[model samples]
Target: MARDNKAMISGFRCLCAFIFVISACSIASFLYSCQCTSPCHDPGREWGQSLTPNQTIDLLSFPEAWNNLNFPQVPPPWRMKIAVFVKKWPHRSQAGGLERHALTLHLELAKRGHEIHIFTTSPINASSFPKYPFPNLHFHLSKPTAAGYLDQSTVWDQFQAQNSSGSPRRPFDVVHTESVGLMHTRSRKLTNLAVSWHGIAYETIHSDIIQELLRSPEEPQAYSLTERAVKVVEEVKFFRSYAHHVATSDHVGDVLKRVYMIPEERVHVILNGVDEEIFRSDFKAGKNFRRNFGIPKSKTLVLGIAGRLVKDKGHPLMFEALKQMIRENAKFRETAIVLVAGDGPWGSRYRGLGSNNVLVLGPLEQAQLARFYNAIDIFINPTLRAQGLDHTLLEAMLCGKPVLATRLASITGSVIVNGNVGYTFPPTLELLKRALYRVWSDGRGVLEKKGEVARQRGLQFFSATKMAAAYERLFLCISSMSGGDTENQCQFEDSSR
Candidate 1:
């Protein structure tokens, strides 16, 4: 039976590889035709306007005004009709990092008066659509599959009907896909469309390698290295279908440009952001939360790990490190307690460590997440996945808590810019143990100071306002190419650039 199963898996892989090669060859001509005919490809065209060196820098780099920490909200110069394509809308019960990002970013955009249309899969419960506070925001739901994935064809059909239905035929100024409109983009090319990539195939390949290395000898590998390499090639080819790309991290932007061969001008980096109002520092709230949970004041160093507890999230490493810390160091067993948030298979395993050592909080709503962040001394994200930036780290930082996370490029380059904000270690048992020990030795006072720095950094770079402004700027730039009024153009320039 085992031999037969192995043979079937091998056959499937071979079939997939063959299909990918054929698809790549088939799309080569289509991609070439797009480049030749697309206005975005012509350097002399309006969409391809030559930006001044300073304007180019401003578009690419983080603005200096953001460092002030009191940077005022600047409304967009003009409102727009934005079509958003995402897999799911965030609900109180079920919101992942991507869902939270879509909610935060588009809400801010809608608040600034953009007419937003969200096209997504139907809610889990048909009768319970999420209600938002924004007036101009509208939703178009496509029936989901049994497994809850989006029906891409239905979504695209809905978008087409809406795009051409109005009396004067109102068209969307710009189309934004949260990595869900690939099929539509592939079906027909649209110059004004921009796709935001949370994670790409190259990153997934790296994640696969990390997972395989971290897996126990008793476990079987999910995909061999060759299979992952084949998938990467397939993904990179498909990625070229979209004219513009939004990379969620600096590292991802670099990968899109260098590894996937996306043009530098077509790739934009906009780091993920959190809600500042909700995740702000509140000592009283933290104290109240600790008390409500019956945590004693003597527990000086409270460690937290949020998000899904699956093995790919690096929970195995965290479990091993925490277990070792509790067993070896008597001080940790007494002075520290680990709070595990979110739900997955590893929750029971964490509980097996004893309730006294690890407190399993399961999944939390946004408000509860704010309290959870404040109640802890430091946030630990031992994620092995090196794809998108994790929002929990930013949320914790916004709440004035330092982070101890894996030394992935996304975290190190974007999240933890300096050593003072937090600690980072390679995703290994020994290194993670050493990092935990160091945090233990530093005590709560040192962590508090680091948390303060982290708060400022989070406000400067990871605030919803900053993220919204950057995206609005990109939208304006893309929309202007289609001959909007001069007043609609992006006129705001940063001299500091």
Candidate 2:
């Protein structure tokens, strides 16, 4: 009996040792994945992971590299006290158009000597994302919901208290609210108020209807009639309020003027921009990029698409079009492959489409994304519902990849002139297929030439520097009209320190 007990104890010890080893290995693998190190050393490995510590430091220190967006030289910089209110800010794992726009614009502004106070729910964890030193920039972090949405009450309470009597802090020169953060507040009593509108509630409802219509026979409806109506009313009511509005694209500006009945003068049309230094044609494209994403290198034509895998993003249309092509066109079926980046609720259904060639690479970091863009021959944006301008399209264009996007949106047509940067198709499987086939048959030379044009156009118009400068000019215009400070100079303060 004593010998039996000893044997059992020995077995338990061995099992515990095995478990410890497995856990250690898992932890190491995760750390390695998140580590910022050079993985692909070859210049030809454009999609290779080459994030060295030195490169990161250089990216941070070099103003020219960071602000590659071209702008006319200004006299001495004007410093303004700017309050930027955002519901969400980008982090390592999560980001969208709104976050990217806010970050890019604010960073450039900070570089230009403006003091910025960011009131946001999405604060980067210090362990995960090291906070870069920006002397004039301060973060007012607030607690958010489990799903990452901000608790607006915190922001409102802070603002009210700061504005209330007996407060030591001075009032902000200008307040720039993003999305519906300003809508939640009762007081538009601030000296100068501006909103960076990405999309209003009506566009969301419109997208839902399109998605439901595209659903399969057995698929359940995504929204109810009552919900749609309520959202429209809420959105219209929000937009109807008067303030200086920053529209991300020409299409969005029209929506503000026509749908919301905002005065034409109040609407500021500033197109969102890309960081040309990070996303450029200099990166060499090769099989390594494909291997990084588990994509086959030998495919004749590689197509890439990135965004949330949601109903409105037109993933359903893309899947259906690919299925039809596979059934009807033999050449496309054999030679073409689609590489998908990003993850969402509809991801499983997308994978269920079951084309062996369609590879879905879940969300990737910016560096990883640049590589992915280089690996692909063509970038596809089949977004049916107009959601202002998509940053991915600009990023792809900056990387010298031609985009085939839908013509429905106001921005896509403006950016992608047919036969110039890329071809735009109507939101239909037949139209999309034809465009795809046309590009495939036109061969690599046609795609490369169009991509070169795209790079030039992107640099000329959509640099982050240009977008930031436009916002600064708008701020000055609004400030001057308000009779506040005609000089439009920023006052730097190190409040966060």
Candidate 3:
């Protein structure tokens, strides 16, 4: 009986040891699986951080070296040499919307591992633009003529010389130029040339003419008559010089096909993008930004406008509508303030109309402008031009501020929906006043909700990442088609749009 009991105890001990071993194996497997999945899944990080010596040697042949910072998933590097031409670069002073558009899009492309060469005339405000430095990027500045214009031939000649070298070492896969870059557009060497149209210059001239008619005849002309006439002729010739065109909006695309007679197949619509990283919602930032400008916290609403403060920008119309609103309503005069962020000849003309309600804080740099957008409750774009949507609208919307723009087809045709992101009013004073009163009476919470919706839309549709990807795809598509193959011409349009 004693021997049998001892044997039973030994059997129980063996069973207990088996159970402990199984649990240990299970825990070890679980931890091994988690480590396998968690630590090395990031593609950018893997490329940047864990390259072998041979891989490092391969990557070193290219200009973009692997860095520790993990970037968003970018396209497989095409490693193509690309040349870009712009009338003005956003380096010196306050760049116009077009210049900013070019800079932002190109910089994003550079980050994605393309070799980029920028050719431009020296900025008019050289003091404001120091030398810009970027890895895998080169800038060639052409000296301006005594007449304060970049001589197109000088740039064209340099481009030709570089491209004609026939050395595989200096091969350029594509050339990109702005709409105003007439000489570059005429390049015969690269069939893969593209022109980006920010706005139709003829339409701009027409709008400026109408604004001039509204001004007093005694007021000096905005430009000498010869300069005005010369600009019109230049625009006509430039559009006729047709290359593949990129229009920043559907409205601009329509204008390209209809007014400019660009072939539908030749024109691609790629909307302008905003840097979502910079222009994002910050409730706490609002008070700080306003405080910097001496605006009181008690002010119920702030209406902000950022762009050139010129007649063609529809500042006069905006002032007329605001004055009429103030005269008709007392609450608007007391509760709301207008912050104009730009500089132009029209700044001093309508300074005293608002009785201290309007504050024109001249041209702001991009960083200050981001803060300015955050400070405002709503953005008002009263532009009366037939020109396409402005970049300011996207920037404001990205910052979670709903935009109230004039209901021109140009503004209406973009991503903005009436009463969803913001409201749009007719250019008429009565309509503007009605829109203003509606926002004023509904309270700030209503606007804040709409601003949230605007931000969501901006994230989905107008991000710089998406924009750069679209352009890259288009460039690749065009490069492929330039090789005696026209079958895939529409291959990237859907992806880009």
Q: Pick the candidate with the highest lDDT.
A: 1
Clashing pairs for model 1 are: none
In the range 277-367, model 1's lDDT, one tens digit per residue, is 8989998888888888888777888999999989889999999889988999898899899888899999999999987788998998888
Q: Residue 284: error of model 3 in Å?
A: 1.6
Off by over 4 Å in 1: 1-72, 165-169, 182-188, 484-492
What shift in Å separates residue 90 of candidate 2 from its native position after superposition? 1.2
lDDT of 3 by residue, 1-497 (tens): 99999999986776565445445534754664467542222222322234332232221111111122122346655566778888777754467767777888888888888888778888656665655466777777788777645577888776776665534556566788876554634653457888887666645654655566666667777653334444545655566565577777655665565546666667776777878787778767767888877997667988898888776678887887777776777777788888888888766655676536888888887777889999998998878776755888998889998988877645666656457789888666667778888878777899899999888877766777767776776676666666554545223111111
lDDT of each: 0.79, 0.68, 0.69
Every model's TM-score? 0.85, 0.76, 0.76
- Relative to the true structure, candidate 2 reaches a TM of 0.76
Q: Give per-residue lDDT, candidate 3, residue 269.
A: 65
At residue 107, give the lDDT of candidate 2.
Answer: 86
The TM-score, computed over Cα atoms with residue i paired to residue i, of candidate 1 is: 0.85
Q: How accurate locally is residue 164 in candidate 1, as Cα lDDT from 0 to 100?
A: 72
Q: What ranges in model 2 sit over 4 Å off?
A: 1-76, 122-130, 145-149, 160-170, 221-230, 283-287, 291-297, 345-356, 486-497
